[model samples]
Target: MSLGLRTLWGWTRRLFPWVLAAIVLGLVARQARMVEWAEVWVAVQSLAVSQLALAAALAALSYALYASFDLVGRHLTRARVSVGRSLGTAAISYAFNLNFGSLVGGLAMRLRLYTRWGLSAPTVGKIIAYSMVTNWLGYLWIAGAVLIWAPPRLSQEWLPGALVLRGAGVALVLAAAAYVVLCFVSRRRQLSLRGHSMELPSGPLALLQATLGGASWLLIAAIVWTLFAGRVDYPDVLGALLLAAVAGVLTHVPAGLGVLEAVFAASLASDRLPVTEVLAVVLVYRATYYLMPLVLALPAYGWSEVAARRRSARAQAVGDAPV
Candidate 1:
């Protein structure tokens, strides 16, 4: 990379969070005007306390599963951190990643925290890469299954035909399966793609990644399904959520704000679920699944960052003392 290009890339990295925030704010403002607040409120209120509690519990479990991915990272890097400590850090970073964008949340925060905790930059990078794979393995399988057998009621504008959807589904399933199969059969410890190579986790480790990943996706869909009060098919809800997730990532919208709503409305709305009800349910899901955790994560994340920096500084000072 040229010096000017490198400088430009650095500036873009630093400024990306702000850009994402601006986009989110603009999208929120536009969507806020179009939303039917009264209907959303009614839908929100229709949920009984017991149902809400159930949804919250599901959300908690889902978050726990995601946090456990930190263990995979720990194992991959052979980091000396304890399970409890790793889980705590992962929980905080995961919350930030969900609300903020991945740049500031998962990638940056994990890099910052793990390196402070004593891992090198390359180790942290590997951890992040492995966690990402573990995170998405299940989504691919779920997407494939749903697309092939139980795709949502998307309009022609959203999805053209079952054949195309099924083809895509097969591709997804094969891609996920191929990873597992290769990991199982390959005697080599590294996987190469293009000119880049990744150190492959052991076959059992790969299997664990698939299982935990699949469970995480299932738990997420279950939370949304619970919020939907079982009114919609579970597969349809999963499919729509998978679609929203993909859209959110592609659009680079923070937490897929507005994208999820648009995708869900397009995929789920029907005689059974009017557009308003669909919007309302998604709003509640966002609150329960996204906003609530972010509320709790911010303080801890800030405190940990400060504490980690201070600890590192003290250690550095001690090392540099007259000897």
Candidate 2:
């Protein structure tokens, strides 16, 4: 086989899994009857400006938390990239992640921009890795908080599911921390620290970043819950949110698509919130998290594409010109 054909085959191999995952998720969503477009439209229309604003704030908070991870990663690597660069990449990457099933699409976009800014592949890889790690650490933080706060927030009868969720949260936290320590210890200096001129500090500052990063994610969750404060009555709003998060992770679907809806429905139904309301809240969440970010991303994507093509064309013309 030709080298070009082999490259094509490899690309196809990479895409097959995403295609398969999408197909399976679509089938499950269909069977689950999770999508009722008419109802979703009604819920959307009923939303007041206040609720919409809260939802937007939630979306913004989520993005902020994400961007914070990039900032933390940059600091760790001692990279001189500006916060604005981090924010731009976060927006573009998130937009792609929401629409496309694979996180790789967004990561690819990030890598390209960072490379254009003179970042090396190892630097890019380390930034991406640290950002993801910090994000998950935030999940552990929220989960732990929900477990501790749920019982006090709600009645004793409502504590069972909360307990189960709390247990899971604690387990995830321990596992994630253990994994990070192992990676740090095993990799040592071989670990890609990016192109930072300064070495990452070991003690207090590192601890602070991880802690604040986790707190930022919880703030995002609070923003989401605030949007539908009166619409749904889960025993523990925070706990349910975290549970939905866990379900989303388990689904491995981008933006937690069907998985979020399924887990949300099951969790709310257990708490006796109406199916219609659960669907409503979930739809609102998606509108804020997915649709809004996507609309915001279009212009940035277009500009980036145009700029990139122009650069590519100039490079090619220069290469082909008579010397």
Q: Cα lDDT of all candidates, in order?
A: 0.83, 0.65
Could you tell me the TM-score of candidate 1?
Answer: 0.85
Off by over 4 Å in 1: 1-35, 193-196, 309-323
Q: On residues 1-323, what C-alpha lDDT tens digit does candidate 2 reach at each position? A: 99999999999998876765565466547637755557656765776788878778767877766666777667778776788887787667766776664455457877877777678877876787777766676667556665655632333332345567568657866765654565445534334344543234344545655676677666665665766676554335556666656545545767777666655555554345555566677778777787788888878878877987899899999999999
lDDT of 2 at 45: 73
Per-prediction TM-score to the true structure, in the order listed: 0.85, 0.72
Which clashing pairs does model 1 show? none
Q: How accurate is candidate 1 locally (lDDT)?
A: 0.83
Worst 10 residues of 2 by lDDT: 151-160
